[model samples]
Target chain A: MISDSPLLKLALTFGALSLVSVGGAPAMMPEIHRLSVEVNPWLSNAGFARDFALSQTAPGPNFMMISLVGWRVAGFAGLMAATLAAIIPSSIIALIVGRLYMRFSSQAWFPVVKDALPPIVLGLIVASGVVTAQAAVSDTLGFAIVIMSTTIVALTRQNPLVAIATGAIIGLAAGRLGYL
Target chain B: MEQSADSSKTASGRPLGKLELFTGFAEMGLFGFGGVATIARHIIVDKRRWMSEHDYAAVLGLGQILPGGNIINMTVMLGDRFHGPLGSIIALSGLMIMPIVILLGLTLVYDAYAANPDVRAATIGAGAAAAGLVIGMGLKMGRALRLHPIHLGFAVTTFVAMGVLRLPFIATIIVLAPLCIAATWWMRKR
Candidate 1:
């Protein structure tokens, strides 16, 4: 029988994540890197990096990294626990924060929060992309993928989903043909 | 902060309220597939007309820089803009609750089959779709910003630098954003 301990760990990490991560998931990159790679023996940095890339390219959210971590640590059960842990605490916080923000929204200081938010978020997104690219975009094949994806994104008005679908189809076909 | 948008009547000629904002956020949470930011823009600018595309871009730019979820940041920006602090809270709560519920549901299915080909295929498809959505949002941001040729040049150059030259994302943004902003301001003045 599989244990539930990893899942609990995920929940605790995620809860702590929501509270401390002022700069977003990328801001927590150092800590996550430390935990997943240094403190814990669950996975190598490269393995975690691969999962991070997959999650970034995958649908849903970056937090899905937790699921990948869970999978590495404890298989499918770990995945569920990690995924749940990532989702729940932030949700509850959102509920309470949302309620409280409503109560004091009109106060003068609130706008300050609004004003401070944008630059930080923008910086983090760029940082997140950089971190992903550092790990994922290696050599010619990876570079080609990044270039093609960016060009298609820049030039086309087609739904972005279609672009990703196209890439996956190619990846799958390549994999099937033993090219990957 | 403009008078028109702050006090403007929506296309439906209905004044939006706290409930509408909450419901809107809930809907976004539920159906916001593929690059949450893209879906976010749709809900805020296109569907709800809660804010203009430009405003959305500003807030999105800000949210992306902060920690946590970009969509959550957008929720806060919108909530604060429209209804003050309480609205931000309502919006954030609505956005988060849906996904937690969905993930919990996923846990049940996950337990049933660890190596389900269908689930694997779906996630792959979803991943590809997500990449596409982000590309789409980049396109949308390009249009919404109505950047000049120079600004466009800066964006394209950075994209190539980041995507091709494999330049660091933060470093490029740091170096280029000021140039872009300066050029934009110069162009606007002319």
Candidate 2:
């Protein structure tokens, strides 16, 4: 039903996500996944997973997934709508809040609000990780790739691009072996 | 510290030109593959000397608390700081324009190649790694918080509700966020 006018749907969905996307783009992954895959059926689970992967591989903000989803659903118009919708609302809010904060930075309530946000944001990020991991990992090799990549990223200050490249190679090999 | 001081000495000590703001953020947008936060810090505080480290941190903190992408929010704030609404618009354009074009091009290539077995496999692998990156980021952020017991409890509850139980994101945030804030406020008052 919502898919009928996918451009409008894409704009509204992404715009809504934009406002609530505390901690950044990744923080809103679960909702993005839910809206795109489950509610709207814009992308299948695997398709959404693939788009998510592509977003990470592409340069720029992780929020690029919104653009990819738009492109997949409705071409260039959809992409523009989704990207602009996802960015503009929050950007405006930030401008207003930034102005206000600059004026009232020393107020007592400011630090309290600041102190409270990190844990909640952390939780949201962890939830997003779980959602993506569930979508991506299925087999033993997939599990291994996830674990290895996690270890590499967690233990070392290495660029995450290395882990992504390594995972791609491993997956290619597994695919050649018909294990994937 | 030393690097920051040296950069400040060399800085032109003028409000950034609109073009300069655009180019600076555009560079960060282009090369900020995994994330732009660190690169933004380098440009804004360490290299450009536009803001002190303390000021940058404060702005970054505010960005995190607000909605949308952190870097985008930072750009908005930074741009406004120098040149108000028009400056903010330029900063956002500079940050998004090149990357949008590049991503669209990549999307076209991806769509064309998506049917291939190799492409499928590579995407799967990259997806898994991307998931890992998310987890790694969560772990790092979680560790950095050094959460108090109450904060940990809230974090765990949030994880369970949102991640494990698959609760609706908006509802969960609305319910949990204010509670967490009140808890912190109480903790601070004591």
Candidate 3:
């Protein structure tokens, strides 16, 4: 069962993921979902969505969600495995990039990669939104919350915490009213 | 770039003590709720004057292009600038330790209350709402960049490939990254 050991799996999955996590954690959400939800039955889609929502309510780095995935799979040790695996490789690259960034930025190829990365990352993000929504939404109310929250956050300069908190309050009220 | 980091040192800047760096980053990490960067900007630029505003902006820009979490990269660069690799490690640990511990604590509480219906309802609602935040974040990033037709095409393609098609993300990115970069190169040349 060494092949199936959750700790090893967490280490491998996140270790590789840290490197490709361009544009930070949100950009990798699509891939994160694919692996954590589908590739491994570590958590259901709704559970994944809930975990993400939960992370937002807490304070930490954007990558904190990965810890939840690890925790679900293998508890405290799993969490450590995932978090360390996620941070170490990427941080090393970051250290190297920090050293070379100025040198690289002036080069011609730099602009191309710079120009290319944002859009793809954006696409991944929007895709993550859709995937999360599909899992979390179960009714018209849930659908409306996503639509409204998206519009409010995108159009206005409101803090995201406001939207999330408001959503939680609405959900509580809706639950009381038997609409949830 | 090194020159700027070197030259712009405030009286309090340059070789910022290991203790100061650790405590500073620890505070940043602990309070980093929605975004760590804003707090970082506050502490680094306004509060401590560790880096000038312009310098902070430059580091942030570099942080974005780097391969890790933008804030994480920012910490590394700033730490390295101040105290080299040792500083980098200290800053990172200081920034992460409390947050990681707190996240673990939250997970413990959530696990304890897993069967609670009220918690379930609210979490689901919150999840639904947070989905919008993700999409909106993408839109905000899009607004920041000048969108070419090529960028749009690739964005849509990547979205469909991953979100709709549910292709393996690692493989999808592998195939797409080079192709997208190359396509970008071709477009630029044309």
Highest lDDT scorer: 2
- Residue-level lDDT tens digits of model 3 in A1-180: 897888999999999898878778887787888889878888888888889998876776788889889888888899889988988898887777777777987889887887777777888888888888888898998998898789877898888888898888888788888886
> Distance (Å) between predicted and true CA of A1, model 3?
4.2
Best by the DockQ measure: 3
In order, candidate lDDTs are 0.55, 0.84, 0.83
Comparing to the true complex, what docking class would candidate 1 get? incorrect
User: How high is the TM-score of chain A in each model?
Assistant: 0.70, 0.94, 0.94
Report the error of model 2 at residue A169, Å.
0.4
Q: Measured by C-alpha RMSD in angstroms, how accurate is candidate 1?
A: 8.1
Give the per-residue lDDT of model 1 (tens digit) for A20-102.
44445533444455566666777674455545545454444446666667776777687766665654455444434544543
What C-alpha lDDT does candidate 3 achieve relative to the native structure?
0.83
What DockQ values do the models have? 0.16, 0.59, 0.67
TM-scores, all models, native as reference: 0.53, 0.94, 0.92
The digit string of per-residue lDDT tens for model 2 on B73-137 reads: 98898888777889899988888877778888877798899899998898899888888888888
| Candidate 2 wrong stretches, greater than 4 Å | A1-4, B1-12
**B53-133, model 1: which lDDT tens digit per residue?**
775676565554344565666677667666766767787677756654565455545446535554443333333333333
Error of model 1, residue A71, in angstroms: 7.6
DockQ of 2: 0.59
